[model samples]
Target: MKNQQDHIHIFSGEIADYWIEDGILFSQSKPIKRTVPLIQENIELVKKITQNQAMPLLIYLCKSPVPDKETRQFSREQLSQVYKAMAMVSAPGLSQLIMKMVFQFQKPPIPIKSFSREESALQWLQQFK
Candidate 1:
């Protein structure tokens, strides 16, 4: 098994930093802030990582507030193509609620869920592996 940080790909944006381990993509992001070119860059990196094989993904949103319309739209448009499943780690708060609502409305192509702990997120993602 790879160490948690072995495949981390640190990004230059406030949106998130990503990594790949055991065919799963792990992304850690802060609260919704500037999310323009950084998100695009992150998407490109994800594409590169999963170029040959699709992988499940887990996103850890630390203190992430609800995302704005533009950022939500970007995710709705781009995420499903690269990942088979996505799990998000966030506490029960506005961010989690908003994410659930968005998922309900946008209906991403792959399966998605939110958990309050990293272990739970990883466990959920494992089914997709």
Candidate 2:
């Protein structure tokens, strides 16, 4: 898959494409419904890439349809299982709002933060590496 980042592509799911660089696992989601199976694919691929070790995640939030409640819960519960922390990269306004809106009712299972720039996200994620 084509990416703005200069990292080797690792996996491409229905919802997200993944790659790894400098101990951070990066994902850029497509504008599609993120399903449970797709999220499972995401976890399995990340586990393989990290060799079962917990690595920090960096995801670029996009205009994907909000996942169903069950899928959202599953994604939340599996966060600590696959990643030590997560950094979400989004533009300064609505995407960030949508991201938070999706998970606002519950605290994240791991460290989660949002940034407007990939550089900032990577810089913040370095602490977890």
> Each model's TM-score, in the order given?
0.74, 0.85
- Scanning candidate 1 in windows of ten residues, the lowest lDDT window is 1-10
lDDT of 1 by residue, 1-129 (tens): 124564466543447666777778877775666454666776777777667466898877666555567877777777666788888777677446756756757667788887877788888899899
Q: RMSD, each candidate, Å?
A: 3.4, 2.5
Q: Candidate 2 at residue 59, lDDT?
A: 84
Off by over 4 Å in 1: 1-14, 32-36
Clashes of 2: 0
Residue 34, model 1, lDDT: 41
What local lDDT score does residue 101 receive in model 2, on the 0 to 100 scale? 63
What is the lDDT for 107 in model 1? 69
Model 1 lDDT on a 0 to 1 scale: 0.70
TM-score of 2: 0.85
Model 1's number of clashes is 0
> What is the per-residue lDDT of model 2 for residues 1-129, given as tens digits with 9 covering 90 to 100?
225555575687677777787788888778988788988987887788778999998888777677888888888888899888888887777456765766779877788888888788888999999
